[model samples]
Target chain A: MEITPEKLRWIYTTMYRIRRFEEVLLEQTALGKSMGVAHTSDGEEAGPTGICAHLTDDDWIASTHRGHGHCIAKGVDTAGMMAEIFGKHTGLCKGKGGSMHIADFTKGMLGANGIVGAGIPLGVGAALSAKLKGDGSVGVSFFGDGATGEGTIHESMNLASVWKLPAIFVCENNHYAESTPVEYAVSVADIADRAASYSMPGVVVDGMDVFAVYDAAGEAIARARAGEGPTFLELKTYRYHGHFHADDPHTYRLPEEEELWKARDPLPNFERRVTEQDLMDDVEMERIRNEIDQEIQDAVKFAEESPLPPLEELYTDVYVNYSNPPQGLR
Target chain B: MTLDLRPDPLGPGFDVPGSEIRYREAFNRTLGDELRRDPDVFVMGEDVAGGAGREHLGIIDSWGGAFAATKGLIQEFGAERVRDTPISEAGFVGAAIGAALTGTRPVVDLMYFDFITVAWDQLLSNAAKNRYMFGGQGKIPITLFARSGVAAGYSAQHSQNFYSMVAHIPGLKCVAPSDAYTCRGLLAAAIRDDDPVIVCNHKKLINMSSFVPDESYTIELGKGRYLRRGSDVTLVGMSYTTEVCRLAAERLAEQGINAEVVDMLSLSPIDEDIVLESVTKTNRIVIVDEDTPRCNMASDIAALVADKAFDSLDAPVKRVTGPHTPVPYSKPLEDAFIPSPEDVVATTVALLGA
Candidate 1:
């Protein structure tokens, strides 16, 4: 894939932004600024940024609960997202959805789902709509290896393949699903091999390497847009934190495994690759990181200063024109 | 019998001068008309266009949907709009919700109301809460249809009135169309609605014919109308139970008793005003439901009246509903399971002390 100067900046910047954004958001959540649990996607930055790099606002992506990285990568406004997670009036979901349900329809980011495997079919439906409209837009579903056990994913993959819909199923295998290991749950050794059952091409990529994710995602996305049908991508990655804000990985996973994955962090890997290839200098990379660091601080301040949603807002936005409130809500 | 109403549903620019048709026909016609009206509207579900994608073998649309709700729709709208899906209930419903979220309107026929449990998570989590959770980013304008209530010996699973379950959620809109007229009006209203609306088509009422306007129109969502006017006692009904209330009212009239009937077209954003108004004037009510007792629609309406209309009620609010038991397969047992017109009359008589 051709990486222009501007494209290269965006790729690096997005990955860095995702990492910093999560680091800062975790701090805020720890401070009790957020109303609900915040599922930060720190170590899994490359999985979303690389895939989203090939997508535009017209294309759609459905995300899992660990979705903050996907939201940033999809170009959702961080201030609105921060405020939303902070439970402020100016938040993306008007303080209603908080962290788990942040979505911008205009941006084609089809919300971070609260349910485990629920977003799978939703993305496939968008692909179906795209096919019917004869539009070139492709829909992507970002899920974890744990979600493979869900019936919706399997059903959706078959539907997309039968209709030859433009959809990319990106399975980020983050080693663990909450407290359970993938080995104990999933029948197959590789999630990608299951794609064969649905008559679709499946590719496995290194989730820690931005280039690998970008390369695989670009080819899969191109194939979808060409009407060649859906592709299943299993991205081998890890999460720096627990399943949720309060979870502790010490109970389920070992420190050695954590150290092995963290050693190949996407941000450091990208910096080394670019410097060695003479694609970008260390100063330029540092400048981008500094800029993102400030952006994260500004987002935190905006969220802190924003007001909480009013009492009346509790009853609003349930339905577009439901003037006659449900008897109980009223 | 020529239907007569004090307010006159056919009065002054209302009720089109057209033909009488079965509730099923109205259902089938409205879908085709809606598909024609909007390019974005599409239908999907098991057997919605049953034999689709089999044009090579000279077979087409063998099932046309479960109750034949989309019987002629495929021929008019084509197979592209009329989608026949696998029996994966959760998958298709999620896809429908996704399609609705991104602009198009998807009308999904889930065959039986009993099967709603299979896809309950999708309906409850995604379709219902999409807009609310996203803080008004988009609307889930998906209309779901499922056959409800007891037809015969379909047994426990087939015959169920789970409207109260959907209505229990704050985000979804639930409706039960009573006859051809309501089936036509309510189905159209549900299609155009911006929120997720579940239209419960009762199995017993599908073949029943009533005067239906040929012209396209929508019955206002969350509104109920008086089927018959009387000052004595109010008989509240939903779906097929409304027919039971009407029949009981007719019988009561012959015995010098005046019973009013209220057909609740919508259940979620319930027509609280109409129910309150009827109860306040008549000072008595008998709510009829076909679902199993305990946290069902009958109990809900009873609670609503007791909470709001306590001062106006002269007699205790009684309920005539299916007993707390699964519908039996045997003829005699199934007959006993469903609340009949006689059941309504007996309950109303006891409530009135007459």
Candidate 2:
């Protein structure tokens, strides 16, 4: 498929937005402006941006704890997400879901789950819903290599294939499942290959290449939309930071491996690709970067200025219409 | 057939005419009826649509859930509404919770109650607590149906009854109907409830036929009923154990001991009034449970009676429960493990001093 200029710009802008958002998030965390443990998707941008490029706002996506990239790619409001991470009332989940649980159902961005591999089944369920409702919308479950070891992922894949549900399982194989390497936990060499066992197509894509992820995701999503069931896409990538922002004293990872992944950073590689092919002008790219930087800065400002959810809010949203007030509230 | 305002030991209402449908059939009917009644209601689970990808399907809903509860739903509702999930309990269960929060009432089948461990966090943390945690901002009207208890030789991993585990949680309501009548009514009520409900359908009760009302009905939560009222002793049971309690009551009757059999249908907000009433009348009590002895419903009820009706008791409350050991595969060992009608009778007789 030929890449259009508009699509290329969309991809670049999304990547830049996610990168700058995380950079600011890290800075905020360092400055004690944000509470809760935050995991930045700084290096794993290509997988989310590429996969989400094929999805409409109506198409649902379930993200992992390291989900800022997925949130941006799926078009969640940067200001709301930032405010959410800051535990402000203006946050996406109204400050209920923090860094690990940010969600925007309106955009079909299911909350970023704290549990590994927990989102796979939820995506399958959403796909099942779409298939049942004949909505033609597909559900995407994004998880790390660690999630592949979860039984739910395998079960979800099998069910999705058997029912021919409209869903895509995107395994962001970011080398580590927390401190443990993928090899130590996952028995299979290729996470995508496991999809074959479920009688579905499994594709291994370059997690670092936004275009490659887009191409693979496009085909899988189209197939799902065509009532062809689910696809498992293993985006071979690596994370540049420890599992979480709080994960300092990074003793588990080899410094050289971290350095190697840093060198293959998704944003710079996409920048070089777009500039080299003249798909985007350097000046325009710089303009987009500056624009995204300003947006992130504005979000940080909004979050910093935003008020924390009132103590009374802790009692709200527990039930849709609870007859009696919850025990604590009472 | 009238809605009894008296709130009997079993519950307030008498049996609705058609309340006796099999637990599995009632579930499917409830799904179909709810879906037809409300467009937002849908069903999703593993093999809920028995024959998803067969070459030439001869049978309908070949899987229909291991017990065929959801059979023929796909044909009526189509593949979209009657969704068949992969074995991803956490995924689909969590998704069902998400969908419930997003204006869809999803009835998710866990297949076996024990498999709930895989999706425990979602069911317990998210679905159960979401409403209370959100402080009433959200309502998760998700009904989780799972076949519980040791029956049909399915041992250990598949047989344990964890309803008490759910009952222990403040936000969740747990229901275990003794027969088809209660199953249908309770299921209908569960579908309409704003809170998350875990319906523990006994594996043995799937094929047990009962009279069911043609019209829709609902059995209220947190109620109990007197299956058989007597003056000598009060026997409390839940789920399959209700049958055992009835049989024990019958046996005790032969020995001139009139026993009151109480089916505590809802475990969470237990019908303390009925239990205390029965205890006050009989002045002697025996609690029968299919679950293991420790931290089970028997203990909960025993504790309740001791605290509230201690003066009314003629003797210490007797708990006839399944052994604490994991359910064994061997028929004899399994039979020995679970509380039997004879065991209930013996316990009641021992307490009553026949």
TM-score of every model? Answer: 0.98, 0.85
A261-327 per-residue lDDT for model 2 (tens digits): 7888888898898888888888999999989988988999999899998887766665444333555
DockQ scores of the candidates: 0.81, 0.27
Worst 10 residues of 2 chain B by lDDT: B1-10
**A281-323 per-residue lDDT for model 1 (tens digits):** 9999989989999998999999999999988888788888784
lDDT of candidate 2 over B139-201, digit per residue (tens):
678889899998879999999899789887767778998887788778888888877888999
User: Chain A TM-score per candidate?
Assistant: 0.98, 0.97
Measured by DockQ, the strongest candidate is: 1
Candidate 1 accuracy as TM-score: 0.98
Candidate-wise lDDT, in order: 0.89, 0.81
Give the interface RMSD values of the models in order: 0.9, 3.5
Distance from true location, Cα of B250 in model 2, Å = 5.6
- lDDT score, candidate 1, position B110: 88
